[model samples]
Target: MAYETVIVEIDEGIATITLNRPEVLNALNSQVFIELGEAAEELSGDESVRVVIITGGDKVFAAGADIKQMASATAVDVSTNVRPSLRTFNFIENMHKPVIAAIAGYALGGGCELTLVADVRIAADNAQLGLPEIKLGILPGGGGTQRLPRLIGAAKAKELIYSGDFISAEEALRIGLVNKVVPADQLLIEAKKMAQKFAARGAVAIQMAKTCINEGLQMDLDRGLQYEHKCFSLLFATEDQKEGMKAFLEKRKPNFQGR
Candidate 1:
């Protein structure tokens, strides 16, 4: 679907959603948030799309939220305006398929929160990420407070959020915030390469694995193991599971039909 603030492209089982507001350095606003949710929903329901990537051209992932849009708002107005974004972030985090973030330049505040929902993140060497909302007398309204700590540990999360300091891509990688960092020009290529690798896997197993990990994070270790075993046993009923094991024994590539 065509979008004013973003671009969606699907090719060879991969869907790429590009944040397209170069004039404002892809600063996310309410409209951008709504479009992102719509695009994510559309892609999630598409059977042909095996993996998804969210990017902001080569220059910048996103600067932050469009602060000017909220600078004049009252407390009640600000509360109401952020509801859609919160819902959208939740949807992306729980989506059935894997979601990858391809980040380049500035990714701050809401932009950084957006990346936290992605299953994997690949950043360019030029990337600068942070949660600087505290400087503006606000906190991350997206899922940053929750997911960031889960990803990089509570102490590191607190340090970054409290200081409002930007971290280099390499620093982000060291903290486990991003999975990989490549040269600026190779950002998209690396992201697609990783996506292609994931796309080649059995869709059913991948979905189950993602669900197990995401849901397990909220449960005790024993309960999480029980949940994982249930999902593991359930995959045996799928055709992909049978084909994958058979092909493994035969030393051949398995053709997964996503069944």
Candidate 2:
């Protein structure tokens, strides 16, 4: 599908989705959210794309939600707005393949929420991440409340929200908020490298692992372990597992087809 707010490009088992609204700091409007969902739907269905990297254009990853739109919106708009954005986020998190957020400049409010949805986040040295929605007289409408504490712990998350402070990429890495930090100019290159690494792995195993991790997190230990075991057992039935084992014994790299 053709996208206006975003650009989706696929190559070598990876899909790069760049938020293209640099003029507005790649702000999340309802239309942007809709386009994000449409792009994710297509990427999720394309077997050639084993991994996805979400980034922003120009100097900012995203300055957050479109402030003008949000300021003019009503309660109904607020309620309706979150649904599409969260749906888009969940689409990335719940996809069989991994999604990586390559953040630079600003990743505030809704944009920060978008970063949290990815399975992995890699930010540039200058990236500024925060949940500043409270400053706007509103809380984060996306998954901020739920995902932030989980990413950076309750105390730190609370500090950021209550104070509306932005942390640099270095601090984010120290707190385990982001997986890696790269030079400002190399953010996309580094993000693509991570995507390629994920693409080379056993796709089915990785997908099941992601499922187990996501679903099991909401359950008790015993139930979660059982789900993990089920996922492990299920993988034995896939052609990739057979090929993986054969490739192992043959002393050669496994070429996973994502079958």
RMSD values, in order shown? 0.6, 1.0
Clashes of 2: 0
**How do the predictions measure up, each by TM-score?**
0.99, 0.97
Write one digit per residue (lDDT tens) for candidate 1, span 219-239. Answer: 999999999999999999999
In order, how many clashes per candidate?
A: 0, 0
How far residue 208's Cα lies from its native spot in candidate 1, in Å, is: 0.5
Candidate 1, pairs of clashing residues: none
Q: Given candidate 1, what's the lDDT at residue 149? A: 96
Residue 78 displacement (Å), model 1: 1.7
Q: Please, what are the lDDT tens digits per residue for candidate 2 over residues 1-259?
A: 8889999999988999999998889998989999998998999998888999999953799989998887787888778777888888888889888999999999999999999999999999999999998888888778888888887899988888888899999999999899999999998999989898888899899999999999998899999999999989999899899989999999999877777
lDDT of each: 0.95, 0.90
Please report the candidate that would top TM-score against the real structure. 1
